[model samples]
Target: MTAAQARTGDKNCRVVQWATGNIGLRSLRAIIEHPKLSLAGLYVYSDAKAGCDAGELCGLPPVGVRATRSIDDILALKADCVLYMPQTIDVDDLCSLLESGSNVVTTRTEFHHPARLDRAVRERIEAACRRGGTSLHSTGSSPGFITEAMPLVLLSLQRRLDVLRIHEYADCSSRDSPEMIFNIMGFGQAPNPQAEAGRAWYLREEFGPSLRVIAEAVGLSFDSVESSGQVALARKRTTIAAGVVEAGTVAAMRTTVSGMRNGKPLMSFTANWFVSYDIDADWKLRGDGWQVEVEGDCPLDMHLHFTVPEARKAATTPGYTAHRAINAVRYVCAAAPGIRTSVELPQIVTDLSAQA
Candidate 1:
């Protein structure tokens, strides 16, 4: 049987957890507790995490699966699917996984829309799937949930569609990740050319393809994708949970990735992420959640909010991202070989029977 045919059923899917980061760590815990899935192997990037047990890394009892740092070790291991959630995209590692007879369900946001991907990269990934007869899928909360899942439903009621836009909001005033805020996100740093360049690159490379997925699902063609953003600076120095936002530093950022059809945006995804409401710019603060709107025959507006308390945000928020990808394992494994966009698969159903 082909590897796709050999992928086990929901009752006993063998899964490998890759990179125990925020979302990946929660997924590892879920895999250990999930009745339908088994933790076959674990992959970690740090030497400190390499020898630790998978369950322990996730704050659970040992599951007897030790984490490894070698790609060859993971390739030789037998697994029906790999949860490829690293901080960045590594097409080489991903291709090797698919070509090694293991399917992939990732949060990397690289394969959400195959047609939008660079010609050579998309072809390389598809070729790997063909050789191994395995399937690969990409999913996560923002680009996956607010980008594809929610909009897909909102647009269903519309017949003569004009435009669809999705917005992601985050109130990061109470976030406690200092490294993430000050260093990685450049929250308290003065605006520089490098920061603008980085945001533009992310928009074109990562979130750009996701916008195209929305258009593809709705049968709209994109002439091009327009990417842009502007930074909101702090008016005065203020201390929040993450760190102190110095006056005139970057306090917030808004990024817009639009799928343009005939020089106009038919579909757009905007990210409104702010560390404080005391910024010099007049930006909306809707707490931490998402808002999706469609202007069409039906004309509907809706917002999905995160209800997690401030104390539990770090622990609970990742579940929103991890669970959807985890729940997609069965459908992805059952899919035909190649990049499985959300539109091509069935509605993902959560197998929560084990929770009882």
Candidate 2:
């Protein structure tokens, strides 16, 4: 039988998990504890956790899913879907999963702008998704939630936007791994190299993705664009956290972009991050000859419209990001997959009005 046929043939709706990091653990918990989903199998890279119960890792009661070290073995289980959260790994692993007919939802930033990725990787995932009739979705926080959904909501005001700026601050020190610190701070590099080139591609994938959402809402389009970024330096008296970072170093960045309409700058945005505590997405607009700023109490309260304890806020972002990743899966499963730029996805809010 074909891989697609094989996947559908499995009677048990096994929800396989890959990676056991913070997000992976979060996905695992969400799946097992969620009333609608089931915990099937887990794919942990390290051998130390093999054969251990997945629930124990999350400090939850046993749910019967065991962590395994082998990808091949996990695939052999014929899982219905896989929740993937690899910080750094070959894209081929993702392509393999797609080809194997397993639906996927990943927090990897690679899917933000799929077109620019290696052709082989893109084609492999697309082909596998198509052949298996399975779906592949790319989503996460800055790029997925605030970047896409928040901006779309701003358009409800129906004002002409002269400039669109989104400022976000994520405290990476709170993360569980050193790799996350570097990813956010842009470690091991001179100050602001991404800005000098006018090509902060990652920020573009995010800001631009978000920009597109507002653009569609404001009823305008861009003919050209300009982006720049800068690394900001600050003195640290002590480590940002107990185990995450030291006292002295470049700790954050200021990324900006100017999206133009008909060669004139119409919308502009700035994104900022720091080692200290702050997280939000705000916007400025001009309509009816008035200027306004759309600011949220915090990123979570602003994005999801609910206030959470400051101490628990760090834990909240991943789940917020993970849900967006989860939403993306439903689309990829329908035989429509590709390098979907912000232009392709646009921006639409699913639950904002319901909260009221």
| Clash tally, candidates in order | 0, 3
Q: Residue-wise lDDT of candidate 2 within 139-206, one digit each (tens)?
A: 77666555555555664554455555555544445455455555444532345564434436656654
Total colliding residue pairs, candidate 1: 0
Best by TM-score: 1
Best by lDDT: 1
Off by over 4 Å in 1: 1-10
Q: Write the per-residue lDDT of candidate 1 for residues 1-356, one digit (tens) a residue.
A: 23233333435889999998889899999999987889999999999999898988999988899999999989998688999999888889999999999999999877888876799999999999999889999998978877888888788888977888888898777888899888887788998767866886686677778778777787887898878888889889989897689999988988888888877788888888788788887676688888888888898889888999888988899999999999888888888999999888887777666757
State every prediction's TM-score relative to the real structure: 0.93, 0.70
lDDT of model number 2: 0.59
Q: What is candidate 1's local distance difference test score? A: 0.86
lDDT of all predictions: 0.86, 0.59
